[model samples]
Target: MVGASIANFTEIRGYIKGRAVLGKSATEIFKDVVDIYGKGWMSYRTVCRWAKKFASGRVSIENDTKTGRKVSISTKLAEARIQELLLEDARYTVRELAKLTGVSSSTVHFILKKQLKVRKITARWIPHLLTVEQKRSRVQCARKILKMAQKIEKNNFPDLVMGDETWIYFENYEPHRKISNKVWATKAAKRPCIAKRTMSVRKMLYAIFFTARGLAIQVPVPKGRGITGKFYRDVVLKKLDKYFGKIQPKSGMRHIKLLHDNAPVHKAAIVTDFLSGKHVTVLQHPPYSPDLSRCDFFLFPRLKKILAGRKYSKRPSVGSAIYQCLISIPTKDYIRAFQMWLKRLKI
Candidate 1:
């Protein structure tokens, strides 16, 4: 139990060497030897092991994990098992994984909480109406790009016009609410047509382009009509002819691509023949795929913005106002809206 000589770092190391050869335990070594180097910061057990190794003349320091030897889960194994379970069934509930892994539910919960990092939920599909198959078809019809080489051979792509008609009835306003819920309930009981004042109006059919980095009106229905397959071919083809007929093939325009939904008007017999005769390639969107349609996604909102909160005297008056507003919305805005589709097409 003699005090060691005070010295520089080298002298301290030498003192540690002499004391360690004298064979002291970790408590003794840490109290005396650790101050030699690294500014007295070498840990207690660390000091003990280095001195003992030096005394025994062991060639290597044995670095190891021995933190009190408490039982612990193998993190690597836990991660691998978690991944395996996730792949086998992505929807596997956390509780279910706990049972399968024989791990405590709390531990499984912690793992998922820390690492799952899943996104917030979103809508899977529109309610009712179109089946899964129908939604897929509609997007394809609207967005499909064909090589205009065949069009170059004959020229119809620039003439390609995609048109869709959508409804915006005044009666179609989102169900109303009031600040005073109790007072409004009785008033809300009556049907919107009779009780809640509304004047429903129809929007004219709209047709536009989805080609060569642009979109514009081929023909817009200045006045809307009840949708049917027959009306589409007849009305759509005629309007296309009226507008695009003016463009010559040598003007660098080729092939006409027309897009519309699988509504009754689109598949009319007269419409098919009209398209074939004029060399217009009519593309039918999948039913229930309105989410992808330009009319549904782009134009209707613009029209709604035009009509939003607008009070009309009657249905006919509303229709007239809509027509005037339609003409006012610049073609470039519609073009700008369709160009947004390009962003979705990217990876």
Candidate 2:
């Protein structure tokens, strides 16, 4: 075999030109070159093109340089530019950044990801945009909860009952339809279609209370009636009180420590007076801080996920489904949720 060091484009093209002058066909010339050099030394089409070029009185064997835009390589300047662009507007896409920075999309992506060590992510939705005072209040409340949790015995954690109110829709559409409805299919098979359905306007306001043990009570407000301070105090708290009496007959509602969000109805004078009179200690909860609530973070999200993509014709059916979903949750999950709540408070 010919050594690679002795093999050059000029030398190979000259050999092809000489063979063409000797009346040798392109195919015969290519096979002779392969036998001398190697199997992949030159392709038959390349030999044929060179033979035609020699016949047309072409002398130079060197390849001509083509003219176009030079490929952009990742550099420190490009990385810095991408970082600056991201700082100016994080929403800038790879294509937009490429156009702005005078680089290809792949180059911009490489600099952003590999050099800058950054990744794009969707923004998380929070309950509210809190003011300075609200932020400070949340910190204070979190610290207080952390201290309380440290003092409480592990067994007595069940005494801390967390409750909240949310509207349960009769038909809850999946948040991500494309992902949830995805199915396995062959490449030739047509994609399946699903009819788009919006969230139902028909919903019932439900106040749910639970502890580390399990669900205590879930009260659905009557149709055409909204939650008022009087209703919450008389109806919601009354049922909770009854449940407590049935479970802890000796201690009644005295040992209960309620943790609920700071809705106007919950903070009303009537509700405050009722709780104070009943000796049910309401834990301190900062306004607009749903992240700290177990119901918001754990229970409601899981419940909604299970109920998503299901349609109910009647309100009673929805209520029954919710009941089943709630009870069906394993007891270990409730315990883990409470543990997570304490961990979050510490954070």
TM-score of each: 0.52, 0.69
Residue-wise C-alpha lDDT for candidate 2, range 1-347, written one tens digit per residue? 35553456568898999888878888989998888777776788999999988877887777767865543454667777888888889999999998888888988887787668888899997658999998898889888777777555467485788999988888777463357678899999998876564544788889998877788899999999999999999999999999999989998888588999888999999999999998988889988877779998889988888898788989789889989999999888888888887777776
Worst 10 residues of 2 by lDDT: 1-10
lDDT of 1 by residue, 1-347 (tens): 12232324335445556677777766776676544454454556656656777788753333444665333556446756987888887777767887788787866776676556553354475456766676565445435542333442243233444566655554334333342223334654863332454444433444443333333343444544454555566665565565554555343223566667676666778877777777666655555555546666776666666775566545566566666666677766555554553333221
lDDT of 2: 0.84
lDDT of all predictions, in order shown?
Answer: 0.56, 0.84
User: How many angstroms is residue 179 displaced in model 2 relative to the true structure, after the best TM-score fit?
Assistant: 3.4
Assess the local accuracy of residue 347 in candidate 1 as a C-alpha lDDT between 0 and 100.
15
Number of the top candidate by TM-score? 2
